[model samples]
Target: MNKSRNWPVAVIVLLAIGLAGMAYQHFKFGEERKDFERRWNLTAAQLHNLSIVSDVPSDINFIPAKEGSGYVQLSGKLKSEIVRKLSQTEPASDGLQLDLSSDSFSIFSFDFRSTKSQITVALPEGLELGRFQLDLKSGGGSVRGVRAGQADLKTSSGRLVVSDVKAAQINLHSSSGKITAEQLEGTLTAATSSGGMSLTRISGDGTYTLSSGHLNGTGITGHVAIQTSSGDVTLSQFSGSGQIASSSGSITLSGQRSDSLNITARSGNVKLSKDDAFRGIYNLRTSSGSIHAPDSPGQTHDVIEVRTRSGNITIR
Candidate 1:
């Protein structure tokens, strides 16, 4: 009996068994993946069945249903190949509804990239819900709503329009786009990089930061700060204490009065004007820029430091 012949037979048997096991595993994985994809596609299709009217005004209305807590979220994207189908309204699915409470709070978000898509949210005459959150995003989606208690809105390169937002905590961000908000109350923080920001009135405490753009606010209360790299920083009526800094642009604080006022720039003018008298530790410094404190009659307990590498400092 040759042992070599028995060795060859055993090797052949092992190879056959390995091939069979691999084939079984490959088929099983493929089936599971296919099933998962099918279910996901089905769920998306159902969500697309929801109402998605182009010309219809974008609005989210919520009435105190259970009175314990409630949530509303709206999110969408511009018409792009990557997000085209995802933005479409689908029928409700088991995963579509993210109900926080058994019958209290709900969250809804979608995507829309159509040329003519707009969203607006309004609270009915009398509705005092607890802990409400809303998020709206689009390539060209305009979001207008009255928010209260923690509201956040962001856009990549679209127009953002918000009005009458009264939240305990509010945050808004936009990238390379335009943002307009009015009558914002509570702790608010709005920012835009390489875009424009215009706010009517800000009552409470907040900060606005910009990379290379403009930030114009009508009224700001409490502590506020505005920073820009290479753009204008203008505040019509700013009260309380805050700091405004810019690199190579003018910072005009018109009719501004703060307990602790601080303005610094690398190569731009710092204009601080006050209608009446103010009292605080004022700190104004600029290099290659001017500081004009004409009507600002306050006790500068800190120091009126002005230094310019290549520009003049003017204190009026």
Candidate 2:
């Protein structure tokens, strides 16, 4: 009984001690944090090829440089002693090639101050790179208004925003935090393990995977392969052939697809909007749920196949 009665006192003493220690440390280190930052800049011959590989978790900005500047510039402030990166020209046949990475001695660190740093890369207007590759971690940011032959951007634990990226092949991957992309081209490959994904005006052949969050798309074109588990799948203005599989969440689509499509839902309702552009042979099946569709193929070679285990299928 005595020990139990004294537990609260012990906890209060420990908390007081911890707070006092923190106060002392703050008094000693407050000024050092202000001096932790330094400005840096690097220049390259051209802005045709670029690679950004960072693990320090900072917001990255891609902006237009001065016209005919004949150089790409990297300007940012180092926010911590361990947050140091350098850009160097890479070997290439034509155009400029630059790679930004951590300095040799400070390749990777767990310094918390580095997470809130910022980086900016400036390129000439109307610049299109041969390849744009960025592999970053957390503290999400935006990458916009650039064209590339191929683009691969990945992040986690923070919102990733992309816009006006025209690439031949594009892959956006994130494990957590929301992802928003728009006005993108190429054969897109987008996936999120546990967070929502939103796309607008995405065209060309594409594939999407959402493990346990909402997946939404608008103005999608070409062939697509989408799969979701325990997350809702919603699409609009979709065109061309595609396949979709939903494990346990709702699937809703409104499109102008007249090609072959195969869809399967384990336990989620599937809904297709009634449109004159949706002409196909309907073959809807379900195990223990209702289906509302045409009994015949509607005299079209295009097949729209749907199967569900215990969910309703709606086609009108």
Q: List the lowest-lDDT window of 10 residues for candidate 1.
A: 30-39
- TM-scores of all predicted structures: 0.59, 0.77
Name the lDDT value of residue 10 in candidate 2: 96
What's the C-alpha lDDT at position 97 in model 1? 25
What are the per-residue Cα lDDT tens digits for candidate 2 across 191-223?
Answer: 988888899998799999888888898998889
**Model 2, residue pairs in steric clash:** none
Top model by lDDT, which number?
2
Name model 2 segments beyond 4 Å from true.
Answer: 1-46, 70-115, 255-259, 294-299
Q: What is the C-alpha RMSD of each candidate to the true structure, in Å?
A: 15.7, 4.5
| lDDT value, residue 64 of candidate 2 | 70
Against the true structure, whose TM-score is highest?
2
